[model samples]
Target: MALSLCLPLLAVLLQPAASLYNCSSQYERTPDNSDIIVECGTHTITLEINLCTAQWAGFNASNLALNGNHNNTQCQGSVDDSVDPPIIRYQLPVNNSQDNPCRQSLQIVDEAPDPSGPFSSFSSIQSVIITGYVDTPRSDVGLISYSTDLYYHFSCRYPLEYLINNTEIVASSVSVATSENNGTFIDTLKMGVYNDSDHIYPLVVPSTGLELRTRIFVEVKAVNLTGNFHLLLDHCFATPTPYNMSQSEQHNFFTGCSVEDRTTMTNNGLSTVARFNFEAFRFVQHRDRAKSSIYLHCILRLCEPTNCQVLLSSCNARRKRSLSPFGEETNDSATVSVGPLYTAREDVPNAAAYSNNVAPGKDDVDVAGLVVGMVFGSAAAALLVLGGWFVLKKYYWVGGRSQAFE
Candidate 1:
């Protein structure tokens, strides 16, 4: 009974020390590129510190770990002070690796995620934040309290951003048509419009434009392609006619970049599916024209399990430089078209244009009906003006006669 009581008391006393253990440096230094070199692998991550360089940064370089298991001596690396430069190296698995406790450093979290993906991870190239601590805490850090730690940290990044030379990057974009050229046809893709944000309700647009400023939720998907790949869109726009280079256009997104303020590129290169939303708009040239139609077109490509996410981000960086298409160029991009949709008025959504209940008398207002209503309204206005003039004339004449009698 005495031994059990003592054991519980001992655990309580040691809990704080164990919890407080962290690899904070002896002193803080301004972040620099030469601080440490990092290597990110397919399933593992390696961190190396130079003894000569770390000494100037005041790194504490002690009590390093490679795995959570205390007995996993194969992973635990050595720290030697007697060496000339005193190099320290640690190799461990990434957080998402199959080995649950094998990773003792480098915790990665996704910055971009896809909800409906077949793979265990939503995207091949996901934005992630990798964090790890090096060395034990010391009093020289200037903070006396245990609530704070001065461990080394870096901002969120893509897995392929600093990958170990295993993947190739061929990220280039140019304007191209997604139609048949030289008898080449691309039938591996599909594009559609949805009525809800969840993308569950398919929206069937009119044969011509849609309502002004209605949220046009769109989704572009890859069909028969296999393996891990991401969809990269070069351009998507609304043209007054079938997509020819010779017409006024409103860009929903250009090169995976949003041009309109309300346009949201919710998912790009995140999975096999790419989703975006834009407000419905009529072409400036066709705003006053009735019976006009709008056509939607997009040019997109598929990226293998490499740095596609980073590639899309690069497109966003130079968005302003490539706004207009100078000429047509061709690559692996596929073109898909939707719509010949027309908008009737602000009151009607145009989806109700061709319903079974829409009889000729209820929905169709011919030119004759409009002309008769205008003629009646104009005649009524003229009669009201004549009556007002007669009343004023009679009142003034009566007043003058009364004054003469007085």
Candidate 2:
């Protein structure tokens, strides 16, 4: 009984201890080839170190050193040295097999705090110096040399002004054009009196004022993108309400008249300009000869390309239209199915298989005929030899002419 009790206590004591230090790093190059920036991060801190070098250099994580100022004495932070080794220890030229020149950045993250725990928050950090060593050898010492010392003088937290100033919408480049019959042909429509700076396009109602089934095309342009980002239109909706209402209020009023399309943005230029195009169906309802307009609503979001499927999971856009005057207001929702965004001639279904199954060409037919003729000629020659042997045997043995001549 005593041993059983001791076993549980021993297991609790033998449990593995959690790590206390983590660190990650990324590299970037300036446009003018002036400096290479190294971005390093831990659980609580991030640092950007600039090195003035044109050639690629190596970084050894084992040589990393950090000093923190506490009570006028410098304390060295202890990093967890038991982690697995990183795959890359050196940066090389673009033509080299290991590194990509076009990729100007790298990012790594450490999950645990330093062993010394010098930092409690961004404001608590006083003076810290991080030194990194390059893997290159020195001519005299025959050892690795120090690259640069990065000093942290400012607050560790990212500035609020940088976030606000870095991202903006390009409103001037936004435009719209409509194509009839699901983009089969282009039929430009005149801008109605309702066209204004805020709205994407004007809702033009024909003289008949009946429900005109037509396609609406919207194009949005955005710039100043950082990292791998993709643009998406959440959904398009139309309501029988006035246009003066707020976007949130309008969405609540026309909850059931939304359409979802599989339209994704394309990168038009070098990661700077993003172009988005989507087609929506509009039904211009007429009430008592006065043209009634349906206010359209759409949601746009920029997200990491890999997280698109996760972001779209909660999207409640409906594809099928309701038979009732107002479309289905039920909570049931589904995502629209779509083919590949870009299609090539070779990507067509059964294209290669169909070509292979086609009848043989003239040259192929001629070669096949020659092979068949050769096979038949050989069979005929064998039959003639057998018949000659049988006839000679019958004449010599049955007629007995050879014995009379002797």
* Candidate with the greatest TM-score versus the true structure: 1
Name the regions of candidate 1 deviating beyond 4 angstroms: 1-185, 206-209, 248-252, 256-258, 315-328, 331-334, 346-406
Q: Taking the tens digit of each residue's C-alpha lDDT, what string does model 2 give over 298-378?
A: 323333444444434433453443211111111111111111111111122343323556544655877899999999999
lDDT per residue (tens digit) for residues 1-406 in model 1: 9999999999997665433323335323443445545664423455655544444343333433433333555544555555444556766554534454544333333333223311112233233444554433444655475433223332222221110000001111222221211111134456777778998877766645466777877777755443334665545666666655444454445534435577788887777777888776666666567545656666554554355666655665655644532112222222445666565444434444455756556645665688899999999999999999999999999999999999
Q: List the residue pairs that clash in candidate 1.
A: 178-335, 207-340, 208-340, 208-341, 208-342, 209-341, 209-342
Q: lDDT of all predictions, in order shown?
A: 0.50, 0.29
RMSD, each candidate, Å?
22.5, 30.5
Candidate 2: where is the Cα deviation over 4 Å?
1-211, 220-227, 238-295, 313-406
| Candidate 2 least-lDDT 10 residues | 158-167
lDDT of 2: 0.29
Error of 2 at 58 (Å): 25
Position 369, candidate 2: lDDT: 94
